[model samples]
Target chain A: MIRMRDLRKDFSVRVPAGRLRREKRLVSAVDGVSLTIEPGEMVGYIGPNGAGKSTTLKMLTGVLSPTSGEVSVFGLTPVPQRTRLALRIGVVFGQRSQLWWDLPLRESFRLLRHVYQVPPAEHEQRLRRCREMLDLDAFLDTPVRQLSLGQRMRGEITAALLHGPKVLFLDEPTIGLDVVSKQAVRSFLAELGATGAVTVVLTTHDLADIERLCDRLVVIDHGRVVHDGTIEALHARYGSRRSLVVDLDSPLPAGFVLPGTSVAGVEADGHRVTFALDETSAAAAVAGLVAVASVRDLSVVEPDIEDVVARLYRAG
Target chain B: MAETGETWAGETWAGGTRAGAIRAYAALVGGKWRSMLSYRASFAAELLSNVGATVLDVTTVFVLFRATATVGGFTLAEAILMTGLTAFGFVLADLTVGNIDDLKRYVRTGQLDTMLTRPLPVLPQLVFTDLPLRKLLRLVFGAAVYGVALAVNDVPWTAGRVLLAAVAPLGAGLFFGAIFVLTASFAFWWVESGEIGNGFTYGGRDFTSYPITVYAHWFRDLFAYALGFGFVSYQPALALLGRADPLGLPAWAGFVAPLVALPAVAVATLAWRTGIRHYRSTGS
Candidate 1:
């Protein structure tokens, strides 16, 4: 539902040397990156601090015009018809809220209804659905500023989706939420994607959010998309090394050597041994360790999404 | 989610256009009024403080006028009229355009991103977001003080003059609002120095309160021709008081207050569009 082509956003920043002596330096926030988001696909855009993920999302949502490229949302250029594009897209900034602060949640929703020109019946239906899904009935009458962060985030998400946007751009939507709240938000997004009505692009540092909600991943670093594929594909590509931790009842054998297995480290008392295996079967590695020592307890440590993305960055 | 709950019942709601703009304005004013009502004690104290400060300011002007008796061929009474008229215009500007000063803060902190994504124009939305009801009290206080001063001076008040005097404040408000827009538009390029542009906006009002004749010829020309601030207070009050035009403006120019506001607003709007473009290019 969204397409970006050779997008490049360059900023001319003044290099301040003194009051009278300064020069302009061009910095590219997003450099020659392009991607397409299909309908009902929840894609996670991951990157380090200044990797231009937020810039890319802003261009797609009509909030920022790309400097030297084109962004089309559902076949319309976002820059040329921003107001009309606003109707079809919804955005939520995790750090900021669009709701009126002093007003009650219901009042904010009503104001949004008027602003979006939502029909009365559809507005009512949407409110009902949103309240049920976001669990907003508990504090619907409370002022938004008085709400807890989790509750306020729920309100923000509800407000963004109230217009039934064809696409939703969530910038760090689950940041700073508690564990339960994060899971709730992630599950809600998963259910929304399951409905197949809207495309979702989530930019967040939280790896669990990606693992829980997004099936496809786009890893960007230094203003470029370094990797783009399914979660399993990313894991398979950069997540081959596995760590094996074995707790032995007795000390390891002297000069023990297992084929394709190297000792990573030895913990206290030399009873716990850690091994790094390269493209080796987990069962075979366990058997090799068991054969060399009396195993008490053992576990395989598979790399999570965080380690995989971190590895990609480190490799780059 | 209650079906029977209804807020903003009688307020007219619109997102754009002149009529719709008026409706949105009223809604904003109503919202501010309700907020002020919620803190009655604080509101009363704020009103009293405003009155005290205004009285002190007027007393200073009165003392100066008693000493000089006339300035630039304007008698003490004419000077009072000019002062009162300018004060009224200044307060009206504050009431209407005060939010524009806050616009830079919003933009710098990424609050403007929320505003831009909304369905309404960013300008009108920011205006409606905060109405500044305290300044509205100042507006009433200014008009009342001006009315009393005009009565005490025994200036002949015709219906046309009264209408022009009334409309002058609104025109001045729009003029100041346009300046604020122009100032806030600088945030796109000079993000950290948004407040530097405020020197022109608030400083222009300070220069308008006194007769423009007192300043040097270059400064007077700057305010009149370059800034067009003289049309905001000086010319309108001159026409209302049956005085000769200052700055050699045409005698009938006061009737074109709305037209004068049109170009300032148009230019400010263009500047704002350009600023948004720059912001998009810069991406922060």
Candidate 2:
């Protein structure tokens, strides 16, 4: 449904090249990226900050025109036929909202009903479904600024879907949400995936979001796509070992071992420890850590896509 | 419904193409209407400020005409008419596009980001999103002041004169609106240029509030030809008052006020498109 050919986006920025003088410099935001997304495919376009993920999304949305290369979505050039393409695509920028901050959430939805030109009956049906699916009824009359981030994001998702867009582009949709809110978003997306009509392109820092929502993963760094395949393929290429970080109350003796887990690294001070464990044994490693030392605090660091991608970059 | 997620990519709207866009514009306008309702205090304050500015403009004219019976061939009555017309232009421009200063805010706050993603054209959407209904109050008050000035002037009101006077304000408004749009479009390339609109938009409008011939020859030439402010408000008023324009412009130039305004609208639109093509999301 979406296709790109040598997609390159360059931004010309002015920098002081000499004293009392500045020169325009062209910086490549997305360089030589060739990608194709099929209909109903949930793809995670993941990257670190300034990794050109947002740039790629902007180009796809036709918000930013590429300096060189071609990009077409649903057989339409996004920049040339942007308005038409917009009717078929919905976008949610998680850090920002498209909802009217002052208006009630329902009013915002009604406004979108016009913006997207959904029929009244269909709009009401979508609103009812959105309210129920996203649990938005409690705050439908509340002003958007008053709604919690979780509720607002759910509202945003509802707003995006009201027109029944064929392609949904989500940028960091799960950022800054509580556990339950994250679960709500993940499950909503999971259900959407089950619907099989919406193709989602999600760009996020949260690998768990990628894991839960996306079947295919595309990783970009420094304006280039480093990996494009299944998450397992990325893992196979760059070792998807989950890590457990624990603050020990005391130093561990040398050669301390936990069965089925390897101490990935131990701080010189011996208070902080990291363990690499299999997906299943990650829970067991934590349980075994209680025996090894008094745990101060611990967290299951998500699949280290960044570290893996960093390694892949170095190796390349 | 029939398995929600697996729809085809090539889906078209069931309704007519323009139906959605037209409805969307209405919704946007209605939403803004309600939002503005919540700012009654600010709205009132803005109305007072408009009235205050008009009072000050009239005071300045009275003070100038006090020193001399006539300033640059404009008697007190004609000068008042000029001030009234310019006030109308100011109200018109501000009502339509005063939020040009807010263009950078839209870009910085990422408002424009989401706006571009919509299926609507960005410029029209921005206009709808930032419609200055508050300024309409200023327009109403300005119209009242304009009506009073027309009455006080006791100017001969032929059908052609009244018709020309009535449409002349719209011409100035269109031209000034184009100025506002053009200045705001500069923010896409140079964000700092956002406030630079004050020069042409305010300065030009203020200059038109009195006789153009009062200014020195160089200044008049600069504003009249270089900036086209003469054709905007002054020329129409000149034609109405039966006075030849400064700088040898024919009196009939006033009838073609849209000629001045249309080219400006065209330029503003072109600048806006160029700006859109160059728009880089804030902070890269």
Candidate 3:
């Protein structure tokens, strides 16, 4: 389990006062945030840029000490017992690599085995699992520098899991991956989550990553968690409405509108229109539209998570 | 089951034990050595260049000796002893833990974050990861020079002298190693302090390469006595040579090289701890 109570971190920065003078100012990156993560729970931690997401991760991983508050992972204090804590937690920073640049991918894994002191049997089992699941056999002998970004990400994920850490923290794991590579990574994480042997906390700008992998979502803004619950709960809280797109047989007269729906967009050809539906079922909305006009084709589009999150940020 | 595994794995990991630390260092250093050798051509070329550089340093000392019968009241033979001690200590440190001066680069590149996440001491992790096995030739050359210096001096061997001879070079290595760590730690607070740190680590090596009497009075007082570089080579050389200090210090001061290292080691350890505590990792 991971527990944090009133955790905070403040950094003193220097900004130029004028041409030759500078002054010091204290900036609170994480401010009095309290959170609890249970074992086997995969939570998606999302926030806007500069929302103290990285700061909170750093404190939990023992990379940075909190200015004030209590933080514990499996009952061990992070900062004072970092080395001990490191044995139980694995962290992957997507922007930074933890592998040796000049060595072959296989060699980096071997060295990490020694660093983590994993038993040979356990190490081989994990390595085999990772190789088969992540398709790492293709580039096992290739130097890390020569691997493409997608290949390197797969190798990184493998490295983090080789130690069998109880908790895994991923920051922007799919930041720049292409479509197919992103799917591979997402599916691999989903499989890992299914095992229920490792607690995973991941932060990403890709909401698709969350929707596909995480069951619970935590949204942070301005150093505070503005919302925490299931995706449906978030949609309900923000009044996120589904939209209906209708391809009509002909154009409707100007100012002729559906009784229970609002017009979201209309195609230039006037043959297609989108309506925002509230509480009304897609069946009812389509029926009402069909009664008013001849419908050629129709579909319902789920609420955009990006739009809901934007509204939540505005409300916060 | 996972909770039990966490506690059990933490116990077996050996990160908190002496044996564990040793195994970790060996793995890192061994990996780095192999990594360097993988580029056979580059490793061979770097080895030759390293030997050439070591040869040049010795040639410069010989060239200076040709200009005068004595430098600062010490003969060629005696001065060579001082050079040998200084070179041995500095090279020992340089080839092993000297790469720590690259702390600024690590901090800038975020490699330090990767290291901190590991279950090992950060200083040793950084040192062993970049261990310069290519400089093994320099260490050999330094020991050879010290050997020749011992033969030419032809000083009568006493029990105490033999002990000092063996212990002094090691003490000097420890002293310079502490200097390397202390200077490199300046990067934590001031990222641009690289050049300033070099002025102490490398500059201290050059300053201690000659007799303290060779420098101007005030300069010698500040760098030699005040900063403790005097005990690194010159004072220890005087003890081995059994010569009185022309500057009027007690002869026993030469024997205190190891003793002098204790304080430098303590201070460096303290500075390193403070620096690690104050580390504000780069923004993502």
lDDT of candidate 1?
0.76
Give the higher-lDDT candidate: 1 or 3.
3
TM-score of chain A of 3: 0.94
Clashing pairs in 1: none
Comparison by TM-score, 2 against 3, better one: 3
Local accuracy of candidate 2 as per-residue lDDT tens digits, B1-284: 46343222224574337765777787788898888777778877876776676677668888988899998887888888878887887788777677776888887665688888888888778888878776666777778767877787756667878888788888788888898888888888887775577787778887888778888989988987787887776777767777776557776787776478888899999999999888887543
Winning candidate number (TM-score): 3
For model 2, what is the alpha-carbon lDDT of residue B266? 92
lDDT of 3 by residue, B1-284 (tens): 35333322323353546776688789898889878877989998998899898788878788998999899988888988988988898889998788899888987776688888889889999999999888889999999888899899977789989999998889889999999999988988898886998899878988887888999989999998899998999988988889988888898988776678889989999989898888888776
Q: What is the interface RMSD of each candidate, in Å?
A: 8.4, 3.2, 4.1
Two-way DockQ contest, 1 vs 3, winner: 3
The C-alpha local distance difference test score for the whole of candidate 2 amounts to 0.81
- After superposition, which runs of candidate 3 have C-alpha atoms over 4 Å from their true positions? A249-260, A266-271, A314-316, B1-17
| Candidate 2 residue-wise lDDT at B92 | 84
User: What is candidate 2's CA lDDT for residue B26?
Assistant: 76
Docking class of 3: acceptable
- Choose 1 or 2, whichever is better by DockQ: 2
